[model samples]
Target: MRIKAYGLVEFTKSGYVKTQAVVLTLTVVLLIFALLWQPTGMWAANPVFGFLEWWVLLVLIAEVAETAIMLLKFKEKEAALR
Candidate 1:
């Protein structure tokens, strides 16, 4: 497979951008769902199903890391262009 040799390609990749956006959107949706879950059914007895409430933590962390990396990459490229 041929790969583009253009610098900073991943920064503008559509697939990667879509994946990131989906992750971020799902994170918000799940957080809202977790807030509405009553935990009165199988969720009451099963820890696995209940774990969805805690998924926001992972999502938050992932978003933070993604943001940091993007910022760092931007600055790196900025310095290179100087």
Candidate 2:
């Protein structure tokens, strides 16, 4: 049996996808570090740790938005091809 797929391969090949993956990984690591370093209510006490956590969250949101846009574009292109 044979199967055909569209858009996914091209989507993965995009440079932005790779960049987003890296950014997501780094943000996750930063989030873990922030949580481990301060397990309790320390955001008010520690500005740097709080800032790091907020920055990681914002980056994650941005990455998700970008990925969604890219996926929509790929879908539109594939539909046009068909």
Candidate 3:
């Protein structure tokens, strides 16, 4: 069940934090605009939809973290056995 960091090593990271920082900045900009728009009395209002979208985003975040952790563990095991 070894998970290889081969691709990462071969491709070169330039580091994860750098790319994640860029993404977080972009997401913040979009969120700010989405939240600041003044209502024209005709704008779509759907709390349920917003809640569902947030829920899905959270699930995706959790799944990504879980997968990364699993891969880390696998790599550790592979290293330990060597």
Candidate 4:
């Protein structure tokens, strides 16, 4: 039997990479919809959704940026290990 070895950083990075990709894709789609959504639109007429749209986008952007920074750091760490 063969066993695979992984570093702590590598494991952490692999976990986050998949999650970040999914979140980023969903965020971009949501951002586009938010940008195109109108306050008067039937679905978005709710004051809460209209008011929160920009905030939601800002939060998502911050999250994605943080994930990107972490990914870059992880890559550097992985490179250093080699």
Identify the candidate with maximal lDDT: 4
lDDT of 1 at 44: 84
lDDT of 2 by residue, 34-68 (tens): 65665347555676665766767777788788677
Q: How accurate is candidate 1 locally (lDDT)?
A: 0.65
Q: Write the per-residue lDDT of candidate 4 for residues 2-55, one digit (tens) a residue.
A: 112233333466667776788888888887777777666665777767766687
lDDT of 3 at 73: 63
Model 2 TM-score (2 dp): 0.58
Worst 10 residues of 3 by lDDT: 4-13
Error of 3 at 74 (Å): 0.1
Q: What are the candidates' C-alpha RMSDs? A: 5.4, 7.9, 6.0, 6.2
Number of clashes recorded per candidate: 0, 0, 0, 0
Instruction: Tally clashes: model 3.
Output: 0
Tell me how far candidate 1 lies from the true structure as C-alpha RMSD in angstroms: 5.4
Q: What TM-score would every model get versus the actual structure?
A: 0.60, 0.58, 0.42, 0.57
Model 3 residue 62 lDDT?
A: 62
Which structure is stronger by lDDT: 2 or 3? 2
TM-score of 3: 0.42
Off by over 4 Å in 1: 1-9, 13-22
